[model samples]
Target: MRMTEAELAQYKRDGYIVFRGLFSPSEIAILRNETARLSAIEADTVIRERTGGVRSIFRVHEADGATRSAAFGALVRTPRVLEPTRQALGTGEVYVYHTKINTKPAIEGTVWMWHQDYGSWQRDGCPRPDMGTFALMLTDSSEMNGALYVVPGSHKRGRVEPYYDESTSYKFWAVPKRDVIEVLKQSPAPVPIVGPAGTCVLFHCNLLHASGHNLSAEDRWHIYISFNACANAPKFTEKSRPDWVVSRNTKPLPIGPDVLNSGTEAELVRATSPN
Candidate 1:
């Protein structure tokens, strides 16, 4: 799980890196098995949230995903993911802000536009440190499974404007062709992650990134955990998934609000509150 000086330098300059075997075969088996088990339940089990009439996939924390996969949770603290991040951020003072799983079905039109992760946490120009996001593949990920597309080193451009709307998938869930061309022409080309079932990608929150369509024969499932340095972060942000929660550990975060809760206080509040 050791990240070399060269790899750390690459992340700082190139913006993202892929580690094909972040999880062992047995570990991947457990995750895939559990994910299938959850999906088999009759009901949609998945909760959905809307932003201006657009439905964003959301699933309840600990309800749809495994509650006790130490192997998986260990990813949050794993040297494979953390050491590199610490090297990139130059500190181990980190916090696990939030986590959510992504499962994209095979579809010719499915898309996630290229955008930075900053806007979701920024409010009123309160400059804050961006979170580091890691995507772990539960299933084999490829261009067919709508693999992620990233504009190498785009984080240097500052936060790109995010556009959302209810009109069409291509509109809200697409990276502008101009930006794609701009990055390609001016910077390194977007790299398509190609790997076996257990590939993991670590990306900076401010990286201008987007995922491609998953028209292949396999389902592309990914779980992302947001991590941030305890240093220089804002107190809170005005955002929530309503379907997921954030768990706090030794390191603290400066986030405003979230739709999901995982702390003991939140559980107590949910218990006493009427459904």
Candidate 2:
């Protein structure tokens, strides 16, 4: 669905927005079924399982079964979410950079760290702001299962530095923490975007958001998908992110694919920042 003018304004000002009914009930039903099937057969098998040992997070990129989930692909390309993304980011064609399934079991899992997405992508050669992604809940999400926490206005702030030590506590990477807090000091109260299964939250690449751990018994399943608009998009280097990428680039640059990777816009914004 096209975003309302108010929603669009909020998106532009806050750098993100949460739409209540992202997926149809039938669609969500199918997703839950598929996820259950995947979970039952591959619970201990797919991707990164509880690295914290506390039981708050499960990274699903380590296994092929997780990599190729059909439900995930459908959600990423769904026009409801994609169209708004295109209008916000602007691109003829968009690419889903990667997909992440975060399963927060009720009694286990650690809290998601507080940091910025851009802290990592400050690499020499990588697509910066093509698009950053947020996940859609496949199951009801809450503090019991460590729902996501976001710093509402941080997306419009100055560049975020990497978290050297606590960085890894977030996703794949992060920058320093002191720098982030300094920027966040002027922000509003930390607000956790609330929603049920089938809801999608989209944020800007540099939006400073973080999620906490689930302290309850219910499982919180969220699927995150990264994407980028088709043009002005950094050319795909030979070796890049496996999720959404170019098979080939017509207008090539000096960098080769081995390193011109694709990641959330936060990475690109931080890395490419003139600062």
Candidate 3:
């Protein structure tokens, strides 16, 4: 489950790396089902597009009781995910800052403007950029289906000052067009992250990335789990977003059994619950 030296180097040089077919088809099926169940819920955490299509569901890793997904709970603790995350962050321990599923439905999916994730994380009061995100594709992603596009090695540029924009269909801080242009000038063309279901893309916090609208007839869904070094947890504030968006729990996660391979719902819950 550990990252090879070559993979680590590629991540360092490019700010991200993609592992195709990292999870089994059965595991992806479970995640797809969990996504469907969560999407139907009536909650603030389930953000929808202007057209009423489910956009993103936040804090999925912490879901409890009827809403909980044992599969996702186990995913956070999976060695294939955690070990590489720990190696990439160069930290002994890490915690889930938050987990979210961003869905782009057929032709109704909207665009996510170019931005660095740390732009929002910094505003959330996280002082350091020692964070990474593991995005697991629940459905096949392709150019026609709104695959993510990332600028190679953009993390080396550090955090670019982002402006808050509410005009977009989804409101959030976005990198200015000028800044993105400048970054693109030095780097190779932005790479579209296209892969089949069960693919995982691990990227640095400051990596500049965005996704286009889904013009195809197929849906694209991906669950992203943002991990923060335990030593680099954020400072909470009255102005900060809800805990569902910015997790308050800073406890390091314990590695658990591979539920994708074998583990009952009760065992998965007990293994991931806080001590």
Order of models, best TM-score first: 3, 2, 1
lDDT of 2 by residue, 1-275 (tens): 67788988998888888988767666676656656655554443344434532221233322233334434444444557567776677654665544556666566655666666555443413445556665788887775567887778777774565645543333444535676567567888777776777777888777777666667777777777655554534444555543222212222111111111232334423332223
List ranges where model 1 is wrong by over 4 Å: 40-71, 124-126, 165-181, 237-275
Of 2 and 3, which scores higher on lDDT?
3
Ranking the candidates on lDDT from highest down gives 3, 1, 2
- Candidate 3: regions farther than 4 A off: 63-67, 262-264
RMSD of 2: 10.1
lDDT for model 2: 0.57
Q: Highest lDDT, which number?
A: 3
TM match of model 1 to true structure: 0.72
How close is every model to the real structure, measured as TM-score?
0.72, 0.74, 0.96
lDDT of candidate 1 over 1-275, digit per residue (tens) = 55777877778787877787777676666556655555444333342222221112223222124343333344455456666666666676776655655566655335666667664545323257456787778778777677877878887776655555344332333335676577668878788876787798888777877776667766777777667666635544455222233332325422222211232344423332323
Off-target runs (Cα >4 Å) in candidate 2 are 40-45, 50-66, 164-171, 232-275
Q: Per-residue lDDT for 154-215 in model 3, tens only?
A: 99999999998786556899999899889999898999999899989999999999999999
